[model samples]
Structures are given as C-alpha cells and as structure tokens.
Target: MTSQSISTDVYEQAAAWLERLDNGPLDKLSKRRFINWVDAHPTHKQMFESMLITWSSPTLERALADAKQTITLKDHLRCTPAIRWWQTAFICTALVIGVIAWQLTPNQPSAIVHQYATNTGEMRDIRLEDNSEVTMGSASDVYIKFSDRHRLVNLKKGAAYFDVTSNKQRPFEVKIGSASVVAVGTEFNIDRGQYFTDVVVHEGAVEVAGSRDDKPVLVKAGEQIRITGRTLGLVQSIDISRTVDWRSGWLELDNESLHYLVERLNRESAKHIRIDSPALNDIRVAGRFRLKDPGQALNLLAEVYGLKIEETAERYTITRLP
Candidate 1:
C-alpha cells in the first residue's frame, strides 16, 4: 500500500476509536480490543495521539469560544446554510476534545458536576468525563464530579455498576451516605439501601470505609462489604454472577427476603408491589427472575410460595392464600 493509503487507514481507525470514546468508556472486551489495536502498530499510536493534540489545540478552543459568545449553538447552526467537510469534522472533534479537556484540566474554581437518574423500569448507561462507565439501575440517582485529583460519584439512591478507568494521579471513589469505596481502577457495584450500603468487587480491589472507621477495609475481587451508618461489615466472598446478572435484565436472588425481592421488583415495575401480610416480608426465597416482566416474576413468586396476589389498577398486593 502507498504511504498515503496507509495514513488514511490509520486516520479512519483512530477516528472510529475517538467516536467510541466520545460515546463512553468501552466495555471490557472492547477496551481490550482497542489496546491491542493501538499496540499492533507504532504508526497507529502516533496517528491517534496526533489527532488528539489537533482536536485539543488552543486555536480550535478559541474558535469555538468565539462562536459560542456570538450566537447560541442552535442559532449558529440555523444561520449556516451548509457546513463544509472540515467544519463538520472540526465540530465532531471538538466534542471529544471538550470531554478530554474537562477531565484533564487542573484545579479550577469548581468542577463541573453532572447528575443522572433513571425512572421506574428504566436503566441508563453514562460515560463520565474521565472515561469511566456507569450502568445505573432502575430508580437510581447519581452525581458525578471529576477534578485533577479525584473522580467522585455520589450514589443518592438505588444501585449502579461502575467500571473505572485507571489514572494513578486521580483516584475514583463512590460515596454513599457517610461511607465511601475507593479504587484506582476497578469494577464494582454499589447498592444503596434505606439503612445500609453494599459494595461488591468483580475486578481489582477497593478500599471501603465509613466516617467512623479508623482504617479502610480492603475488599478484593470476589469479595463484598456492607456499611451501615458509621460501621463497616466484615468482608465476605460472594458469587460474582449476582452483581453482573442485572445488566442482562435478570435478577438473581440467593435466599433473599421477600421484602428485599419486592423492593427490587418495585424499581422495575410500573405497577408497584406491596406485601399486604406483614409476615410474608420475612419469608426467604431464591430464584432468578426476569426484571423486564415483573408481572411474571410476581406470578412465579406467588406459585412458589403458595400465596395469593391481589391485583389493582395501580398495584399488586401480596397476601396469604384465602
């Protein structure tokens, strides 16, 4: 191949990877594939770095800043009859560079904070400024802030799985109430309950600590820890599958209480579930159920426990069999 053709191929691949990075941090498999591609050829790495530097150039930043000051984005687009090829490319490159700049910049007056939330039966995947990926569960709320020294996420409600990108200079932390789980680069899931929080690590390790703890507990892969108020629970080995199943639209229950099951079901179901019989809340059950179809899950639960479910317009009430 001619040098020109080789350069074109490299540019195309680099642009594709940049687009993916813009969308969000890649999944584990995709990330591994990306690393392999970068390592396969020195030319590929050089081209990618060149593109990044070009996009983040001060000239482009000044141009964009001037355009923003003069007119709003929508107005600017409306005023332009047709965009040139280079202009279109610049716009796209600017977006990716903007994210990178936001992440890598030093201390400012304040960090840009982004908040994300999911409604009932809804899930969301978010890519942070630092290229960290967060998979939020139904009825979840998270606030993110990235600075030169730290990448912070506050889990206000529900559960989320975090796949953090490594940056030794800046550690990643998830804050739940007065407790925090810290990691340099790792995969972990945090579920915030009314009175407690659970942290499960699938890859690498994390330090878990509460406000009152003197030392943070190191929870490694396949291990789990729980924090309640100012206290941290003992670390224990757990099935990794339990943390991953939710991403595939399945909830794997392992001898969890009926109350806990119902709470999870409520997050994924429009028609809420309520345990009318107080005694049923303490009953233990275990099964893998489909989160997408909560009605079916409730039916299965009713069958397995020999209970009755009273259906209403707004909710399903679980009660003892008549």
Candidate 2:
C-alpha cells in the first residue's frame, strides 16, 4: 500500500494494539495478522516497527506505565503519530478530560525552598550545597541555593556560625535583617532578628552593608559590628574564639551577668529555667561549661557561690539565700 493509504488514525490504533500485546506470548495467528497489517502499506511497516520498538524498550515502557493516571489519552496519542481518523476521535475526549484534571491539581513545594528548623536548646551542624559548613544555634532555620550565576543562603531565624569556603568568583553573602555581610574564605557569626544585626568576624574580613546605605564597612578579625536601623557601631578588640566556642559544645561566659547567662542557658538547655531573686540578676558569672549537660553547669554554679536551686511547674529557678 502507498503512504497516503496509511492515515494518522491507523498508526495510533496499531501503536495502542502493540502496547496491549507488549507482555503476552505471540501466537501464530497473531503474528500472521501483524504481518498482514504491516504489508497493507509501505508506511505501515515502518510505523509498526516504530511502535514495536517503543513498546519493547525498557525505558519507554516503564516511563509510560508509571505516568500519572490523570494524563489524557489524547496527550499520549499526540506524542506518537498514527494512521486512522476514527481511532483518534475515539480517544481524544477522554485524553482532554485527563489533561484538565492534571492541570488543576496543586503541585508540592519545590525541594529548593524546603525549610528546616531547630528547637530551643539545640545545635545542628549542616553541610550546604556549595560545600560550606554551618552550625546553627537554638531555634534556627536556613535554606540554600546553588544557581548557575551565584551561590546563596537564607538564614531565616536565630543565629548560625558559618565556616564559608572560598569562592572568590562568586562571593558568599549572608542576609540578616536589613544588614548583610559579604565575605570570601571567612568564618563569622550572624545573630539576627527585628531588633539587631550583630556580625562578628572570626577570620578573614567581611564587608558589612546596611540595606539603606550605599557603602559598607570592612570588618576584620577581632572586630564586631552591631547595626540597628541605619545606625552601625563597632565593638573592638573582642576574642573571636570565645564567640565561636558553642560549636565545640561549650558556652563561654566571660564577665556576663547571671541574668544574661541564664537567658543564654535557656537557649542551650533542653529544660526550661528561671531566676527567682532580683538581686542575683546582676551577679557576674565567668567560665565555660559543657553544653551537653546544663544540669552539671547549674551544679557548678551552685557549688562555686553557695546558691540554692529550686524547681517549679514553670521552670528551674536559682536564688541567693540570705
């Protein structure tokens, strides 16, 4: 038969028949029928071979079978051409309905924007997509993106100490509030929220820029920048290692008040704690303690200064007895 005799509808019907017969053993009559169909036209043999190859290929067959049920029959037909008009008309309507249903269904959120959170008194170390490392503090969340042009990370809440790998071509940038810190091959801490943007540069240098300003300040080792609104100030000559001690599972309390220390402990301790006496709030506590055991730290605090520890339904309160 001539190519004109082989219509698109005919080819589609033959393809569908091949798909149906994909797994079954071919009988003598069935083989003869197939041969007769192929001989009907010059294009018929070519079309049958194409369909047979498609149905037999492991990759194509597996993909077709695993395809969502919501897919329209017309879509499947459209992807492959056929030789008959009547068969196309028969499958077109069902295919159209399937396409509509699939289109209307909501898709899940993209893997790129998925958010991960850490609870209070917890610290988690995560390796980012760009081969950088991050150790997040209590109640923190972060996301990463490694696009063609640039590498980026969004620290949604709380603080995190970052050991950024060097990528001079595409400098690493961290955003906290309206302030941001950009660096290349550096270690830094960003404590951010609505109230403040505190950046402590441990190694190398960070270019600090406020969202409203045209220029940024270069903060090097032993320096920290605290920004609130458009105002920025520097706290000079601070020990960088002390600031990053939390990564080693230690809370370094250097000339910090008991009230502030307790607050830090609440973030580092799994159990809730409280301060009962107002007088003890201003008392200074200095030293480093293992973050793994807040109870041991509390005991050390009580032993060093003859203090009393009490428990309530709400929290574990520490007081100074007269």
Candidate 3:
C-alpha cells in the first residue's frame, strides 16, 4: 500500500482503539491483540499516540458532546462509511482549533494557581486536578500552575512526593530554586533543604536540570541526585524505601550528619532544636526515629552519639558531652 493509504488506514484504526480505551479497560486477549497491532507497524504506534493526545483534549470532548446532540457517537462509529468520514472531519477540525488556541497562548499566564501546605507535625495527601497525587511532608509548601501545555509545581519549602499521571502532551515539572525536575509519568520525592535540593526517583525516570542553560541529567529509578545552588551533583544509587520513610511518620537515617538530622527534626518539632557546638554539626548518626516525637528522637541521638542536650523555655540545644 502507498504511504498515504497506510496512514489513512492507521488513523482509522487508531481512532477505533481510542474509542475502545475510552469505554473501559480491555480484557487480556483484547490487550494482547492491541499490543500486537501496535507493534505491527511504526506508523500504528505513532498514529495511536497522536490520536490519544487528541482524544484526551477537552476541545475534542466538547466537539463530540455537541455532535452527540444531533447524532450518537456510537452510531457514527458503527454506521455507514459517510458517517465515519463526517466524524473524522469533525474531530480533525476540533484538533486544528485546539492547536491554534494553544499556539495563541504562548505568553499567556496560567488562569488559576493552586497552593498547598502542611503545618508543623502535619502531613497531607492532595489530589490534583489532573488526578496526580502529592504527599506533602511536615511544614512543606507547593504551588501548582497548570496550563494546556504544561503542569508546573514550585516547591517553596520542605518536601513532597509526586505520583504524576502520564500525559505526553503536557509535561509535568517541579521547580526548586533555579533547578527543575521534569517527568512524563513517574513517581519521585523531592526534598528542598536549606542549601540544596535533593531528588530521589522511586519509579520510572526523570530529567534533572540545574538551570535552563545546563544540560539535563537523566536520573532513572533507584537513583538520587542533589542540586546545590545551580550545580547538579552526581547521580547516586540509593535505597528508595529509606528515603521515603517519612511518609510513614518515621525518619530513617544512615550515617547522616547531625546537622541534617537536626534540620529535619525541626520541621516537625514544636520547640525549636539548635546545635550549640559547631564541632557536633558534622557528627554522623544513624537510626530510625518517630517524627511525632522529636524529643525522644533527640534523646536517642544523644545516647548513641554521647552528646548533651540542654533544655530552655523555648528550644533544645545540642552540645558535645563535657
């Protein structure tokens, strides 16, 4: 068959697949058949992906809804060849309009901004409009701005775990200072520290860019990267479970500095924690402690490291044992 004929046939098959997917999940046999069809030709996969993007567009949905008022979509799909041709033309027109509208908004700001935060000792689970989920850690803050082309999140303070839904047409990005993490469909945790931003990918992969001008580093699953200022650190292999232990109200440490431990503890502690002895800041400690009880956590640290804790009306000071 000629290229033009193959493309037209593939486009129709892609539309049919889109309809089937929209109805519901396919059975195992149907899934296998669909996979085989997708693998049969490169054009099949490309056409299906393009159709998926158009199928999920709000403009196409609106156009379909309007057409349903005059003629049922099911009838159009299953009926005469003329009806199918009309349906295809209508959907193509809607896609063209959507593309034009998107191009016209190159400089347009997002219409709405959504902000979410968690208080001291508080953790929150938030569901975004795109059906993505975010687990906000104690004293964490995030601002979400979604447009037709992109979904942007600014991590203002502390940490958050994102379970992003897959959408190739719109990229999901998390901004931390001058750095940003971009992903298509993945789960990852981001911790914004005082002087650095840490990213740990639990599933799939993400591209980490220290700045817009710098080349993006691909951090895959079972990997971690720290962005200090505008520089991207080495990508290191990590225990993903240990990094996300905070979701269970536990802080798991493995030879982390005392300064790092104290800084994390202060986020959930009602009374402030301060390191009085500068020498103690570099002390490496390891343990799993409950985030709900910062005092007990500190006491355990002191016991293990042979440190002293002085209590006042407001804060607890950690010093070297004298």
TM-score of each: 0.64, 0.54, 0.65
Q: Choose 1 or 2, whichever is better by lDDT.
A: 1
lDDT of each: 0.73, 0.61, 0.74
> Considering summed lDDT, which 10 consecutive residues are worst modelled in model 2?
97-106
User: Model 3: how far is 120 from its true place, Å?
Assistant: 0.6
Model 2: number of backbone collisions: 12
Local error of candidate 2 at 19, Å? 59
**Cα misplacement distance, residue 9 of candidate 3 (Å):** 50
Task: Give me candidate 1's TM-score against the actual structure.
Answer: 0.64
> Please, what are the lDDT tens digits per residue for candidate 2 over residues 81-143?
332322332233233222221111124121232245578877888887777888898877665
lDDT of 2: 0.61
TM-score rank, highest first? Answer: 3, 1, 2
Q: What is the C-alpha RMSD of each candidate to the true structure, in Å?
A: 17.7, 21.4, 18.6
TM-score of structure candidate 2: 0.54
